[model samples]
Target chain A: MREAIILPTLSDTMETGRLVQWLKQVGDSVKKGDVLAEVETDKAVMDVEAFHDGYLAGPLSQADSDIPVGTVIGYISDSPEQAHEDQGSIPEKTTVAKGMPVGKTTTKELNQRDTSPVATAKQAVPDTDTSVPVSSQQSGIKASPYARGLARELGIELHQVSTASDGIIHAPQVLSAALAGPVPNLDAGPAYRYKLFTTMHKAVANNMIATLSTPTFRVSARLSFTPLKDLAHEQQQSVTLLLARACALCVQKHPHFNAVYTPRAMAMREQVDVGIAVDIPGGLVTPVLRDAARRPLDELNDDWRILRDKVKRNRLGPDDYQGATFYLSNLGVFEQVTHFDAIVPPGAAAILSLGAEQDGKVEFTLSCDHRVVFGADAARFLATLSQLLDNPKDSLCDAAKDQ
Target chain B: MVEQVYYWQALNRALDIELAADESVIVLGEDVGLFGGSYRVTDGLYAKYGEWRLRDTPISEGSFTGLAVGAAMVGLRPVVELMTINFALLALDPIINMAAKVPFMSGGQFPMPLVVRMPGGVAKQLAAQHSQRLEQTLMNVPGLRIAVPATPQDAYWQLRQAIRSDEPIIILEHELLYFSKGPLEVGLEAPPMHRAQVRREGTDLSIVTYSGMLDVSLRAAEQLTEKGIEAEVIDLRSLRPIDWDTCSASLEKTHRLLVVEEDSRFAGAGAEIAAGLTERCFFNLDAAPQRVAALELPIPFNASLEAASIPRIADIIAAAEKLCSP
Candidate 1:
């Protein structure tokens, strides 16, 4: 028996994985669970284990190429002699092409049959006329009689119906077309190849797109940043951490801001784990600070330092970055970003966007999910935040001392 | 009013009632008098109606079934009990040539009222010869009608209806269904013996089956319902001159059709159904009509192989799924 080793998906965002190297040479006898090769996925390098005990064979894909997720990488044959006989000649995954008759008239068996009309009819027909006239009509669409009548009743042309995965148009395919309103043909405009995206890039894209279904309204106020900035400079702390801490405290005052909108009911979280957006090369990440509302300042500083180092090295696992009840995005470092607003992800009630300090004030924009918090609640949240920023010295020092 | 009864007991009760009501009603077959019939369908009838009305004949099927036909020619309603349809092959000459053609040849002078009741289809380990279904053969005879009842209620209703009709009819029973139980309302009005019955109503696809396959198709319909495919189960109670109006009406509602039969697929009863319906309801079908029938081989003697050789519940479900799938 021979088994094909196909590339497997190693990460949620991995459309393609780059082959690192193969540990086994051609014709090497291997056992099940042996590491055959290493695959580089969207986030990390993972081992591909042998699923069956066999001799490794090639006509294999060369290492360092990004192959599609389900493409065949190599093969394992039953015997060593069979493995090395036809090197570099055997093909990859085989498929019955669409629209081909699935059972291509078993002529060899039909000829061996004692009686066959097909065998008898073969002697009477001429050989030159080869095209099957049945499939040639209606632009070569293969459909059933009832599906044709349904398309006529629905006022849809036969050629316009989308063929199902089996390459035949049926009632279900026609019904789905009736429900699909005005589909666009974007492939006619663009020429492109599938790209292997990093996990961080996928995270940002999906989270942003997911917020489109949420109804959001932004509230902006000019809050003084000098109080928080001076505290950061004097205590050797990060301004973003101090800002997240102050936002967590304000969330503690107004519990509605700590809630997320769910289909069943509002999920009011008990503790606020604030997420601070950080920029890295080629992508972005948000490493959460757990219990930011109750933790001490020095401990928060140490956790933030480690998270920053992990982000720089691209080592943030899902546990370190997921489940943040509130978010803070700072474009203050750019110093030229006049104003901006960040989208509130599904799990968070709101995200606060901060711009560069102009004079002594910073424009803070709060984007809230209206389903969880209304306009008046957001106004009160901003009022409390402005008060905390106006008195950051007492708020941060007294809160840290109490903890 | 209504009571639960086994399929064979219902046929026995119908026979007893018919014999008591008509002075011309007489029954004769091998073991039907002293042995109380092979499947107990004639149990206690010989003692109740006496030896004159119920006569046990010799083992020669062709001669005895011929004797019943000759008796019917003299204005008697003869219900001939053949042990099984496998043996009915020996009597086809008398059944097809005389019983079917005599009334037609006489042209309003003679009316033939004959009922041939026998159990057919794959029973546990009956093997090849004993388990053959020959409804298609009898259906081909021009002046004949065939009723295949699948339940006790239907067996009771259709057997009584078949005895009362003036035409020659064949009651094709399944060997496996003799002991199966259902409610029999004896006084319930009967539909025409040739009419089809919808055992279960659905909208996804129409399953036309008869005899032993009706229960199989109904079980398959239950499984298909859990898979979100609502299958309509139509029991084709009669085979000859099939109730095309009922089946076509079901096809108009559910444009997909699946025909299940215990006979072999090639040129079997299902072949006639799929072709005849495709011709009549061609514009109404959304998919090519499909069939679930016995494999084109002799019924196997081994237990599992015997079960696998004919249309099982799973086979019917899979065929219905494919017909309903895109």
Candidate 2:
């Protein structure tokens, strides 16, 4: 009878333990209580004692993989030859030991069955496998298409081009590999393309593109903020804060503007999670201020401060970036942007973009989703905002008196 | 209303009530069950709950702590008390990794409501081991709720809240404050978990501290008051899910800031508070935030040296004065 080593508790508290060093290797005879490996726990390193006496058969997980606990790290059997044969050189065999309990699968099972000897052989013996499949398209490594093109252009062997992401060749890898050669060609290739956005920017770009593609309408209005500026000067507060207060109040009244769009079922959400687009060095980022309609001006200011700092540091996590029913991107700081069309972020039904205050009046743009909002709703929203901003002194008083 | 009680008594009462209310609540530690705990906080607990709930384990903090982790996973709420935080080193695994990261790593599938209580900070001449204060260590550990109750009301409410929360919570009680008396109105209701409680209100400077240093902060506030310098004292009872709202509000009011902690000044919990405040309340600040903390050295056994090792009220007052100075 052969016994398989399955991870005892898949979701154990100590899921990933660092393998200090594997004491036993393939073909090594192990007895009960024999030292198999050392695992570093949170506190200290402890010896992992083997519970069964068997020959070690391993395509064992390497160190630093943060392997999920209860996943079979290796296999052990009574006979060395049988275990070796049963494992079929570690890469080709995919026969999961049967008769194990439900939810119990050995290391053999985790390996996907690849009847193609060439695939398994490639993993098992890199040199021999690469020599046989020089002309084959599949490199088994993941690299970008540009990288593969550059490699081919440079006459670099596909197997020698080690950098592949999920079998796709990435451009950077190919560029680096090309650089390693003597008198390497540095000029751009026909297949090469420049990246338009960084990782974070790409996410923002995708969402913005999706938003622009959606049915949307624009409404512009100029409100006299001469009173608001005077009020801010008297109250010793910023005009930006005054605008934020008015926006919050408007959100409370025209709750429909504070909504999310659902494309799957063609519905708009009711909850108001307001997103404030803070202009950082890398363009803009909108950190959502949850429940903005309910929170006071002071509270909103507090949230704004946190979000602004987060944007500056580029340390905004998913909680800060995700979820915004509506967006408020103010470009009033720039003297040139008196009025400009604003792009609505995905999930938000509308975005209120405030422009620079000029000639005793502040230009404002209200961008809304035509699928959910209308001209009448935009009019009400603008009216409320204008009222609040015009009497900025009242907004200051309300904030100061907030409990 | 269950009668109002002091923080120490309230904490003890909460333990009693919770243990009585649920069979899953079990207390385990050295000198906890039979000896009634070092501070006698567990006094009469063993007699009432019997050996099951108030079971005592060997001095093996590591293995027994691992046992508690297993017990918690198997539908039991174990309150593992370390006689002093110095001994927590022996159980750092179960506390830091298993108990804290389990819920988060499991993707909310399993939330271990385990509470680890320990007396941290310097009191007498207990030397380096016994007098070590690592509030910052717990603060640095993610996925765990760190509670440092400054007052009696917090003492009781935090423990109760920790029990109710679906996460790991560390209750760091200052050794010097086990018997300190303070007005505590308990039994009516409890405040929100992780919310910072304002101990005193002022407009000039904000004194932020937690656990044992809270006493010194309050005393410093009183001293500053006599000098005509109003200082607001905020007790950050919950370290993890920090009450940023309360701290931000106070900072907005009092531009000058000072943080006091029993931990060392170098990379202490005060650093995080100061850095966070600096980011959120940058424009509102007048003077850079100052931290009054223990000198960067191992706590000594000498009474005078130990006293000097931990932050004193005088240090806090001086820091506040310096911050307020034009």
Pick by DockQ: which candidate is best? 1
Best-fitting candidate, scored by TM-score: 1
Error of 2 at B108 (Å): 2.6
Query: How far out, in Å, is residue B116 in model 1?
Result: 3.0
Q: What is the TM-score of each candidate against the true structure?
A: 0.68, 0.45
Candidate 1 wrongly placed segments (more than 4 Å): A1-183, A186-222, A246-344, A347-372, A393-403, B18-28, B51-78, B93-114, B139-145, B164-168, B185-210, B214-260, B272-292, B302-305, B311-326
Tens digits of per-residue lDDT, candidate 2, A1-403, equal 4555543331113444544456767778999877676554322344556789988776665532333345566778778885675542322122223332223334673354233211211222233423566455445654434355566787765544443323234444566556555432222222221223556777776676566567878998999888988877876665665565667668767877766556564454554677777777766777877666556666767877787777877888889968877777887778888888788777777888878879988778898888778999999899877777766666545744653
Instruction: Give RMSD to native, each candidate.
Output: 10.6, 28.1
Q: What TM-score would chain B receive for each of the candidates shown?
A: 0.99, 0.96
Candidate 2 lDDT over B1-326, as tens digits, reads: 34444456767877888898788999988888988888887889999999989878898989888888888877898888888888888899988889888878888777698888888998888888888888788888887888888777778888878877667889988888888877566555777878898889999889888988887888889998888889999998877868888998998787767888889989989999999988887656655689999999999999888888778888888888776654
**What tens-digit string does per-residue lDDT give for candidate 1 at A176-254?**
7776544443324432222446666886877776788899999998999999999899989989889999999989999
In every candidate, what fraction of the native interface contacts is reproduced? 0.81, 0.00
How accurate locally, in lDDT, is each candidate?
Answer: 0.84, 0.73
